[model samples]
Target: MKKKFLIVVLTLVLSLTGASSAFAYDGWADSKQTAYQFQFPVLGVSIVLNSATDVDWYSYTNNTGSPHGLSAKLQSPPGLIYDFAMIVGGSTSYFSSDTPGGWVKVTIAGNIAPGETVYFQVRGHTYSQFSTTAPYNFTITT
Candidate 1:
């Protein structure tokens, strides 16, 4: 009886150790890196700027079949002097009325169809009157 009870206790301890080892092997996915490419045939999309500092102004122009626009909302931390303009094909077109604060939205007007690509030129100064680099997340959905 004593030998049988010892064997049973040893088996239970080994099972519990195996279970703890499985839990220790789990890992979380990396959020900062993208796992997949954007899907094609996207109707519209939004670009979120997650910057360590204020974002300098940026520009984006669409030449697809439908007109495209860009909007932004300033988060807490240092703000930016937002100025944006777009030139579709050739003509210069201004989209922003006033300097955007908090959140700003700018729309690009042009014919954007499938396969065509857009071009953008963004320039702005941060609250520190210096250039800042920010990670912009663009999500295009059909």
Candidate 2:
């Protein structure tokens, strides 16, 4: 009886750990130093806000030979809104969704040169609903 109980407890713990990790797909780190490295032309990466104050951070490097335009867009679930921020070559720009759950795109007005790096930050809006299960799709283009 003791061995059976221990086995059942261990099984339940393992199952819960796996289930929790399954929802963490594409989650970014909270700080710029430990931000996720983003590749060019990222399409439809699913991410969750997790909480009201949760912030996701990403960094991308320009690998092209010449200067190129860069843009980032996001689509939140219905009834949710999101805020986006970008830092390119020491300049910062901010963007937010005009309509709830609609796609919002932020384009860098200036072109980024080769070997430059851009950092991004994403968070739920002040009045937005946060969810761990419901994710928003994000895209990055250059």
Candidate 3:
């Protein structure tokens, strides 16, 4: 009886640990759905910056219905700048419409100077019918 009890306890502990680890990454689960849309005559866009640790270096989207591409541009106020763009998620085929949208392993260049903020904007178009929440927002940590 004691051996059986120990095994049950171990299983419960392992299950809880796994569930917590699953959400440890910094990213959005539904970025495409939450994206703001422009009316017939206007352009609307939104940007989110997610601070991440070395384990998960960049932010990503978790939607399975459609994939979207993210473009990152690092701007340091007072005239310093750099830009990097990639299709972070979804099918790589340019003609496929069922790609997932989010960031991949791409890294940003330059550090956000003390008291300064770096901006990362992810944008894309999706035809899937779903609703999204705002992309996960992030702040720099010294």
Best by TM-score: 2
| Model 3 alpha-carbon drift over 4 Å, by segment | 21-142
Model 2 reaches what TM-score against the true structure? Answer: 0.74
Candidate 2 lDDT tens digits, 37-119: 76533423677888877888878887877888877887886788888888987788888887888878877755888898888
The lDDT for every candidate, in the order shown, is 0.33, 0.74, 0.29
Misplaced by over 4 Å in model 1 are: 1-77, 97-101, 108-110, 125-128, 131-142
Count of steric clashes across candidates, in order: 17, 0, 8
Better of 1 and 2 by lDDT: 2
lDDT tens per residue, model 1, 80-114: 44333443455654432233233334443335444
Pick by TM-score: 1 or 2, better one: 2
Ranking by TM-score: 2, 1, 3
List RMSD in Å for every model shown. Answer: 16.0, 9.5, 17.6
lDDT of 2 at 136: 76
Task: Give the candidate order by descending lDDT.
Answer: 2, 1, 3
* Lowest lDDT 10-residue stretch of candidate 1: 21-30
